[model samples]
Target chain A: MDLFIAIFTGTIIAATPLIFAALGELVVEKSGVLNLGIEGMMLVGAAVGVWVSYAGLPMPLAIMSAAAAGALASLLFGVLALTFLTNQYAAGLSLAIFGTGVSAFIGKGFGSAPLDALIPLEIPFLTEIPVIGPLFFNYDPLVYFSFIMFGLISWFLYKTKAGLVVRTIGESPESSHAIGYPVIKIRYLAVMFGGAMAGLGGAYLSLAYTPLWVENMTAGKGWISLALVVFAAWRPARVLFGAWLFGSMTIFQLQGQALGISLPSEVLSSLPYIATIVVLVIISRNWQFLALNFPTSLAKPFRPAE
Target chain B: MRFQIERRVEPSSFMRFAAPVYATFSTLVVGSIMFALLGHNPADTLFAFFITPLMTINGISEWLLKASPLILIGCGLAIGFRANVWNIGAEGQLVIGAVCASGVGLFYPDPESALLLPLMVIAGMAGGMAWAAIPAFLRARMNTNEILVTLMMTYIATLLLSLLVHGPWRDPDGYNYPQTALLPDAALFELFDPMYRLNTSIFITIVAVFAMWFFTERSFFGYKMSVGGAAPLAARYAGFKQSGSIWMGLLISGGVAGIAGMAEAAGPLGQLSAQISPGYGFAAIIVAFIGRLHAVGIVLGGLLLSLLYLGGEAVQLSLGLPSALTSIFQGMLLFFLLASDFLIFYRFTPFPKPIKSGVT
Candidate 1:
């Protein structure tokens, strides 16, 4: 029972970054823009977040600054992909490269200075409950933020009027423009929002999860969150489910070791990546379903009919 | 005076040629400012970064030595890029290739036989193709997105390399380092001056460039793939097999990248390790794009990008700057290139705000 709780807690913590990033991207994709620079933005966020924390700022300020840095990075993507109208994929790739270099540069000195791990939020009355409290109530602030974020995103995406406009724009920017909606402006906002979330996800890494600065520390979590958005079929609720699912896969390495599995550690380390390919294959196998759920105008260059 | 971005009826051929030039100059100018920000004299840093590395004959040799893999991989990636097939897993393919080539070089019974080098080359290309073929088969047969799959595979390949080097392939005599045993004499490429790192494997790169030129500029299959890229609907309507293009696109790029890995192992590296590629696969994407997916352009881009690698080291040595500066420059170059590409399709024309309602 104790082992089960540990695994459960570990999975939620592991999944926090993915949930933040995927939920952010879900919104961006729903608005007819694909910012492939999520990885880049996340790195920028992670680097900036840790730097702020290391410089003796409060953790909340560090986290906010990380989100801002991510949003700024996304704005760079917005200028290239949204305004300059470069090929989104290539532009995003360039951003990834830039973010990686910039982060390494930023992280040059912080490698040796590990920050304290984020303290899990504990509500006094809620702490008395048994398994339920441990599973649902005990986690770092970001994990709980992810839960609130998941609910809020679901509410915003499905139950709001502004959400309909974003969805409409994703479906067809031409028609949305015809209906007098400001397509480019809304998309810029969506892209920036996604960037902020990705940044928070990065902060989760440097401040909450691992609590240290490493070059490209986000690793492929940024990319996996991308896959998660797809796996969730751009649904907000499913982003949480998919995050937990991948989180479990990440935890599998540790569990396997504890259970005396003799697999090489490298092989164990590779499970999440291999699982990504398998999940991508599974979700993408039904071509029509992807076509049906995928954001209609995703990755397509849209310049307002001028 | 106000200017309006007007779409060009025909893409400016002049800008098609000029955009990269413009981007290069832009990167240099921005790079100078960056140097100044870091408290170094901009002019001296630029000189050290760009020119000093190429002044010496040995430095020039190292430049070419670094460029060979890039030019080779860029040529391969350019084909796939032209065909709109994104195969960014060239890094993994390169690693797998080095692993295969080194496997042969390490385990062959007659390690000093001339046959060993040739067999290693073949093994390298085969390994790259095999790694790439996974995505090719998935994308072609199962309709998967190659980008995510390929990127995921890159991580797997890195882990696989780490596994090999750390476990079974650890050098017996070497003290606890994760690397294989070095190859014997006959398995290695012959160096040009014996003092320089430039080796015989450059011939393979030269052949690859010409072969790529021939395939891309003078072949039916190449034309078919371009159609697939430029207008997929038209390609399908014309009955060109999209699956065939997918297979051909991945195989050629993967095969060439593998050869690059083979050359690296045989030439200077002479062993497979965790760091077989220093982001050559990713850097080559920038090379291919900057080269405009053209044969001659890729060669120039490779040289230029190699200079960036050399310059990064040069600055690190002279100014004590961090090595990550090279990546910043590479990223900025691509960003500048993409921004300048706006000129190709649009032009800023003077806007006098003429009324359109009544006249029409």
Candidate 2:
């Protein structure tokens, strides 16, 4: 039971960053722009967040700084795709490369440096509940924050007029333009929103999960988030489930290794990524489903005719 | 005075041919600004990064050694990309190839069998093709997004590689480091002089480039791929099975990438290890694009990118710069290239009067 609690705790912490990132991407894709630079942005955010925290800033401030850094990096992507009418794929890839370099350069002095771990808050009566208490009530602030963001994003995407406009832009930018909506500006905002979320997710990794900065520490989580967006069929509720699923796989591999399971540690270590691919293959197996589900103008550059 | 707006004329062929040179020069100018911002000596850093690395014997060999995989992988990728069939999982294919070849190489650990080397290379090619076929299969049968599929496969390959190195492939004699024992000399191929640290994989790379040129320029299949990329609808109407192009593109490219992987494991690293590639598969994507997906052009891009890799390392050692500076430069170059590509296709115009007053 103790081991189960520990494993459950670790899984929530591990899944928090992924949840944050995938949720961010979910919103971005819901708005119809695919930002492959999520990895780069998250990495930059991690570095910035770590560096700011190291400078003796408050942890909350440090988190915000990380989001700002991610937003700035993503804005560069927006300029390329939305303003310059460049290929989103190419622009996204470039941002990834650029963000990686910039973050690595800035983060040189900070690798593996220790910081304060995020402390978990225990609810009084709920904390005493057998299995449910530990699982739901006791977790770092970030874990709870991810769920809040999930709910808020789900509401904003489904229940708001602005959300509908954003969806319209994603579905058909030209028509949105015809309807007097600012397609580019909406996408730009959506991209930045996604970037901020990705950055916070990265900050969670450095400041909470690993509790230290490392070069390229995001380690393809951003890409996994992109895949998660697809896996969830671009829905917010699905994003949470997908993130938890991946989080379980990540923790399961480590737990298996610790328990002296027969499988190779390396294979187990690689299981999350392998699981990501397997899930992608499974979800993408139905081309008709993907085609029917995808936002029609998701990655298409939007240019208002002069 | 009225502003006269004449459409910009297409530059002459000579200027068109020299566009990359101009882009490179512009990139350098931008790079200089980056260096200045970092408070570094631009001239010294640029000279150290670009000129100093190529001026020494060891440096030259290192450059060639690194260039080998990029060239091989780039050649295959260029061919596939030209046909508009992206096989971005070359890294995965490369790892799989190395894994298969190494598997064969491991069983026959002694430096003895005459037929061992050729057999390993064949095994590598087969391994690469098999990995590449996954996305090809999905695209052909399910009409899945190959880009996402191929990209996702890369992570899977990285994990699988890690598993092998850490688990079953871990060297018994060595400490707990996740790596296998070095292959015996008999299993190794002599590509370059061992004394100088040069390997024979460089030669293989050169031959592959020329072969790629011939295949693309002369072969019937090559024409099919070109037509397919240029106009998929037209090609389909012409009865060219899209599936055939996908398979050929994935297989041939995977085979080349596999050989590159095999070469690195057999010729240099001589064992299966976790860090067999330092994002070479992803880097090759940049190489393929910079080369404009042309056979001969890919060779030039490969050499340039290899220089960037070497220079990045040199800067890290000499200037105390972070190793990621190389990735930054590569990313910047790609960003600039995409910008250039946009300018080539569409002319930018100033915003007209607002349809409605909501936009800022």
Candidate 3:
């Protein structure tokens, strides 16, 4: 029972970052702008978030600044991909490279400094309950925020008029433009939002999970979030499930060691990545499902006929 | 004056040629401002970056030594890129290649035999091909996205290398370091000059460049793959097999990248270590694009990128700057290149506005 609770709590904490990043990418992909720079943006966010926290600012301010920094960094992608209509894959790859370099340069000074971990939010009455309370109520604010985000994103994507427009643009930008929607402007906004969420995910890494400013600390979580978006079949609720599933896989190294498993640490460490490939293969085997759910214009550069 | 971007019916050939040069100049101009902001003299730093690295015979040797793997891998990647097969996992393939070559070098009964080196090279190519085949098979058979699969496999390959080095392959005499035993002299490449790192592996790269040129520019299969990439529906209509292209493209890249990995192990490195490459696979993608995926262009691109690596080290030594700045410059160069490529397809013109009477 204790192990179960501990594993469950660990899974929630681990899942939070992916939840934020995957949800953001969901929105971006829905609007037909595939920003492969989520890894880069998250990395920059992690570096900047830790730096800001070390500068003696309040935690909330640091987190907000991280999001802003991510959004700012994503503008480079927007200019090249949306404005100039360059190849999205190449632009996004450059953004990742640039972000990784910039973050390392900026975060070099803050290497030794550690920030205070964000305290888990505890409601006085709710805390006294049994398994449900501890599992559901006892977690950092970001955990709750992740849940709320899933609900809000689901509502926004399915219910709102703006969400329909975003989907319309993704399906066929030409048709959307013919119907008089501003495709480029909407795509720019979607990409920026994705960047901000990716940043927030990075902030969660430094400010909550690890509470330290290590170089390249995000360590492919951004990429995992990308796979989650695909595995979820571009659905917000499924994204939530996929995040938790991957998050559990991430904690297996620690949990297995705790259980006195004799597997080599390197093999244990590779479980998450292996699981990712396996899951991707499994999901992608259903070609019809993927073809149906995938956005028609996901990576295609849209240029209105002049 | 307001400006507008107008799409061209046919891409401008002149702009296609000029864009890279323009991007290079733009990078230098921006790089100067960046260096000045970092409190270094822009001219000296720029010279240190571009010219100082090539001023000596030793420097030229080091330049070629670093460029050998890049040109080899870039040539392979360019072929795949031409087929629209994104094999970004060349780094993983390279690692597996080194591992295989080193395995042979370490375990062979007669390491001094003349056949040992040749066998190691073949093993390396096979290793790379085997690693790449996983993604190729997945994409071809299961209709999986190769980008994600190849990338995931890269992470796995790194871990696999780490496991081997830390466990079974640990050097017996070395004190707790994660690396294999130093390869025998016969297993190593013959150095051109004992004083320099340049070795016989460069001949392999030269041959590879010619082969890549012949395959991509002059071969019928190459034309078929390009047709598939340029217009998939048309290729299908013409009865070109998509699966065949995926397999051939990936296998060719894997084989070349593997040989490059073998060269690294047998040449400057002479042993398998955990960090055999400094993201050569990823950087070679940029090399392929910058070289326009042409054989000759890749050679120039490889030299230019190698210069960047050398210049970064030189600047780090002379100017007290962080080496991370090299990656920054690399990222910037790619960004500028991608941005400038827009000129190939479109022209910027001053936006025509409605002419109003001079009442205002």
Best model per lDDT? 1
Ranking by DockQ: 1, 3, 2
Which one wins on DockQ? 1
Clashing pairs in 1: none
Candidate 1: tens digits of C-alpha lDDT, residues B44-86: 9999999999999999999999999999999999998888889
Give the per-residue Cα lDDT of candidate 2 at B179: 91
lDDT of 2 by residue, B106-223 (tens): 8865557877788889999999988888888888886666777776777777778887887778899869888998887766878555566677667878889888898889998898
Candidate 2, lDDT over the whole model: 0.83
Model 3 spans with C-alpha error above 4 angstroms: A128-130, B353-360
Q: Which model scores highest in TM-score?
A: 1
- By DockQ, the better pick of 1 and 3 is 1
User: Roughly what TM-score does model 2 have, to 2 decimal places?
Assistant: 0.92
RMSD of each: 1.4, 3.9, 2.1
The CA root-mean-square deviation of candidate 2, after full C-alpha superposition on the true structure, stands at 3.9
Instruction: Give the range of the ten consecutive residues with the poorest summed lDDT in model 2 chain B.
Output: B1-10
